[model samples]
Target: MERKKKTGFARYINLVNLGVFVVVTSVSLPIYWLVISSLKQPVAIGASPPQYIPSPFSFANYQQAFSQYGFSQYFINSMIVTVAATILVLGLGSLAGYGLARLPMRGKTTIMLTLLVISLFPGIAVIPPLYLMMRTIGWLNSYQALIVPYTAFNLPFAIWILRNYFLGLPKEMEETGRIDGASPLRIYWSIILPQALPGLFTAGVFTFTACWTEFLMALTLNNSNSFRTIPVGIALFGTPFNIPYGTIFAASVVAVVPIGILVFVFRKSVVSGLTSGAVKG
Candidate 1:
């Protein structure tokens, strides 16, 4: 009977391992293909037989993406919008989260729920009014057009994450700061925020990713090539006559690098923030 139990446990472990392997392989295969396809020569990209391994890897696609396709400008535009939006989200979110978590505000739950509902609204639903507003304010084809909307859209989630994190922090710290005569703002800036770094990083990374990859707003808001972002620019890469798949793949790889680096660097913080208040001992 003991031997049979042990055998069953071993089989279960093996099955779990096999499942993980299959999941990893399924997700990684496309990424592998994208990388290799980006390295392939333009003519070989659509070859009669697919080149799983790029023979004589060429960076010509990358070069053309930057030089001919003006991906550099698109990249710069995306960086500007993403960074600006993330900064605003973090700054405003931390304050709102702290207020909601610690302050004696009435209807805080209602406010939070409303924000959540707003966040759930489809981007398409809001675009027409947003476009009209931007046009009315003369913000179309400008960085603020994207930055303002991105900040507003991402703020609610950031606040939700940060509020939960703040709730998990000990109230004694704030009380002690008050005893020492530290201002509320000082306590928040120096005491609470330092300890909430993980939440902040998580919020910032999410906001950056959303703003970076956003398409519909970036597409509809800015028609000028000078103001175009990576997603829109990539979409408009080729004319009706010819599409450059290799260049598109190369641009995609480049676009993915920043997000990958960010996730790799802040992975621990993201995990901790996500699970901070999930379990209580």
Candidate 2:
């Protein structure tokens, strides 16, 4: 009877898990449908009782999108912006975080609080001022317009993330480095940074993702086709007689490739960094 009860309990748990999986899968159907329909013609997608599967898979959309839209150039612009932003966040955020966490500064709390408060404002609200500043500097419609401003905007949040993780770290590590005759930069570079991999990776991955999918800022800052990013390119697919559904979908899928790969590569760091932050004071 005890063995039977144990078996029944295990079976019940398995059934519950299956039910949950099915529900989650059902919720994801629309997104899956969108991706699938991106491979089909607009007419087929607009038809009643929409087709989930393409009758004949097509690469024409991808070809046309690349050939006509300068999607390749847009992709390159995105890559440059994302890479530069990620590197800046990692280096600058880490250094700033280490200083804030370890080094003493007069009125540090007041300044840190001010920065944190300013950082909390939504990016949309800052757009007007940011655009004006960029314009004054004659950076409007250039990659520099996006790169420099985005780094500044994203820096504070990255600083906070790294600072929290740095604060969580015990001072014993830095002390050990000091006893070994390490200077501040040496300690940060050789000792503290190596151990802070998870935090740095978390910041880097987040920055990369943000920089990649930044639609409003990219759209507002750039007007020319050659300077546009993937999101902006995708947005232009709407048309009167020929809505380019397939092309948009294909581009979107391509856009997701880098984000997906980055997440896959650094997923471990994300999980660890998050769990550490939560469990610590």
Highest-scoring model, TM-score = 1
Q: For model 2, where is the 10-residue window of minimal lDDT?
A: 272-281
- Model 1, 156-199: lDDT tens digits are 98888899889999999999999999998999998999999988
Best prediction by lDDT? 1
Taken over the whole model, the C-alpha lDDT of each candidate is: 0.93, 0.84
Error of 2 at 187 (Å): 0.2
Q: Candidate 2's residue-wise lDDT over 37-88, tens digit each? A: 7677656767777776887766777787789777898899899988988898
List ranges where model 2 is wrong by over 4 Å.
1-23, 238-241, 278-281
What TM-score should be assigned to candidate 2? 0.88
**Candidate 1 residue pairs in clash (backbone atoms < 3 Å):** none
lDDT of 1: 0.93
**Clashes per candidate (backbone, < 3 Å):** 0, 0
